[model samples]
Target: MPHYFLDYQDSFHDLVDVDGRELDNDEHAATAARSMLAGRACLEILRGADAVISVRVRRGPTPLFSVTLAITEDRFHLNG
Candidate 1:
């Protein structure tokens, strides 16, 4: 198992994961990151904060993947 850090990134700064977790593979790490990003608590955060909040998937100091909740605005409606 390899250690993966799910770091939280905002516009101003990044909140590093001091105690990272050891996962089975990259897919597992990515799944965890997505879950953290799209959780119900995060939705509440999105409602209040204007800046985009993203999850940075990293192995040691190297980044593997990055994802965030994207809000699309149009005349008709929106999509995530």
Candidate 2:
């Protein structure tokens, strides 16, 4: 097992996981990041605002991977 830090950010907030988590591997960390990003994105969507959300995975001082979700409203694409 390895220690990983999952830093999360979005249109309105930036949070760092100082305590971090102990996981099996990088793959597990990535999966966790994606799940976290999706949950945050859903919350933003419910609030009726466009959002850009991401989770950055890091091992100690080294960044390993990032998962992101960007949502924007395109009024022109909507059929009125």
Candidate 3:
């Protein structure tokens, strides 16, 4: 097993995972990051606001990869 740090960031918040999680492999860590990102995005949408959510996967002090989800509304819409 390997230890992975998942740091989450959004429009209004920055959460650093001081206590990293021990997972089976890199693939599992990536999946967890994506799931977290999706859950955050859903919460933002429920609040009726656009959001830019990202999860940075890191091993120790080195960044392995990152996943981001951007949600924006279209402002240019035809009037009914």
Cα deviation at 19, candidate 3, in Å, is 0.2
Question: What is the full ranking by TM-score, best candidate first?
Answer: 3, 2, 1
How displaced is residue 32 in candidate 3, in Å?
0.5
| Per-residue lDDT of model 2, residues 4-76, tens digit only | 9999988777998899999999999999998888888888888877888899999998999998888886666
lDDT ranking from best candidate downward: 3, 2, 1
Candidates' lDDT values, in order? Answer: 0.80, 0.90, 0.91
For each candidate in turn, the TM-score is 0.71, 0.89, 0.89
Least accurate stretch of 10 residues (summed lDDT) in model 3? 69-78
Model 2 poorest 10 in a row by lDDT: 71-80
Q: What would the per-residue lDDT of candidate 1 be over residues 36-79, giving only the tens digit for each residue?
A: 87873356455665557689899999999988865433456568
TM-score of 3: 0.89
Q: Model 2: runs farther than 4 Å from truth?
A: 76-80
Weakest 10 consecutive residues of candidate 1 by summed lDDT: 69-78
